[model samples]
Target: MKKVFGILFVAGMVAFASCTSATEATEDAAAAVDSAATAVDSAATAVVDSAATVVDSAAAAVK
Candidate 1:
């Protein structure tokens, strides 16, 4: 009975540790995804700004 209790205790500890690590991994992945989205937004804004500048230059040339 003592041996059985010891084995169960060890198994429970391992399960709890695994669950904690899995949760941390999920959080890290979410953070990385958010960072990637911000980079994409910045790039899109730069492209739009460049297009507006080109349009302004063409208008000035016509004048």
Candidate 2:
């Protein structure tokens, strides 16, 4: 009975460790996705600003 209990305890520990690693990997992936989204938003804003500048310059020239 004692040997069986020890074996079970070790198995449980191993299971828990594996689950923790998986959870960490999932969190890291989510963080990476969020970072990429932020980068995309920033790039889009820069493009819009550049376009606006060009339009303003053209309007001034026409005036």
Candidate 3:
């Protein structure tokens, strides 16, 4: 009976640890995706700003 209980306890702990590790991995993946999205957004904004500056310079030169 003692051996049986010990086996069950170890199994339960292993299951808990696996679940926790999986949860952490999922959270890390989501964070990485968010970071990538932020970087893309920043890059797009910079491109738009640079284009506007170019257009303005062209207009000034025309005048």
Candidate 4:
């Protein structure tokens, strides 16, 4: 998955570099990195939240 993401990022960079100005490419790359980071954080948060919920439910069932 990470490899795929890296490939996509690199592909996007190449495409942007070919088509747009450096300043625009830089801005877009930065924005894409930020968006990807946020998405990872949200996915991690969701996984943690889901695990906690499962654990809580198990504990409740035991009691």
Best-fitting candidate, scored by TM-score: 2
Q: TM-score per candidate, in order?
A: 0.60, 0.63, 0.62, 0.58
lDDT of all the models against the reference? 0.96, 0.96, 0.96, 0.96
Model 2 misplacement above 4 A: 1-21
Model 3 lDDT tens row, 1-63: 999999999999999988765777889999999999999999999999999999999999999
How many pairs in model 4 have backbone atoms within 3 A of each other, for residues 3 or more apart or on separate chains, i.e. clashes? 0
Separate clash counts for every candidate: 0, 0, 0, 0
Ranking by TM-score: 2, 3, 1, 4
RMSD of each: 5.0, 4.8, 5.4, 15.8
Clashing pairs in 2: none
Residue 22 lDDT in candidate 3: 73
lDDT of 2 by residue, 1-63 (tens): 999999999999999988765777889999999999999999999999999999999999999
**Model 3 residue pairs with clashes:** none
> Which tens-of-lDDT digit does each residue in 1-63 have in candidate 1?
999999999999999988765777899999999999999999999999999999999999999
- Candidate 1: how many backbone clashes? 0
